[model samples]
Target: MDAFIGAYLGVLTLPNVSDLDGELLIHVGVGRTVGIWRARHPGDARALFLFRSELGYHHHGVPRQKELLRGAFAGMHAHAHRWVYELDRTPAFYFDSITQLRMDRTSLG
Candidate 1:
């Protein structure tokens, strides 16, 4: 597995997080790759590869991320963008284009 993917998998294995309200949302940004992962089954966590866009590359803008993710999800669905691995069933992980990039280390074990 890729280094980032391995890191994400490791993060998912840590005990159950109570604040997710029955869902797990993960956001990752590495160079041109930025994505959010949702874990439907607590144990079904998996990494997803997302396409990056240079046209809109702002960081941490919740609204922009939401819009971009919504549009990306829609476009992906239309284009049959299916993940090879099982991920969260809910679609809550959104990418914003204009928000500050906070280093959330709480999720890292």
Candidate 2:
């Protein structure tokens, strides 16, 4: 995972990010990637990822990460976007829920 994250970080420039956003709907899975990044490179992940407050909604102290995960599924139905990247090894339930969002086995090269 560290190696993957390191390679991704190597190419994670602002212009590349913009191009990625233009092509696909991306969502960070509520998992160890952020924690690992924070531990490995403190203060850097904060700049790259968005927080709950940035989404312009008040959670009233409820855990917002859970809401964000739920919202990812909700947004799939509410919106017409066909692609979403759950930036982790996605689980089976995800595949069961959304049939169209298949895993792309093609290389990034």
TM-score of model 1 (CA atoms)? 0.30
**Span of 10 residues, lowest total lDDT, candidate 2:** 2-11
The TM-scores of all predictions, comma-separated, are: 0.30, 0.18
Q: Residue by residue across 32-106, what tens digits does model 2's lDDT show?
A: 112112212322221122222224333233234334544443443221111123322222111111113345565
RMSD of 1: 12.2
Question: Model 1: per-residue lDDT, tens digit, 1-109?
Answer: 1112211111111222223344434333442232234356663433333544555454455455434444444433321223311123434343333324456464856
Best by TM-score: 1
Per-candidate clashes come to 10, 0
- Cα misplacement distance, residue 103 of candidate 1 (Å): 21
Superposing all C-alpha atoms, what RMSD in Å does each candidate have to the true structure?
Answer: 12.2, 17.7
Q: Lowest lDDT 10-mer window, candidate 1?
A: 1-10
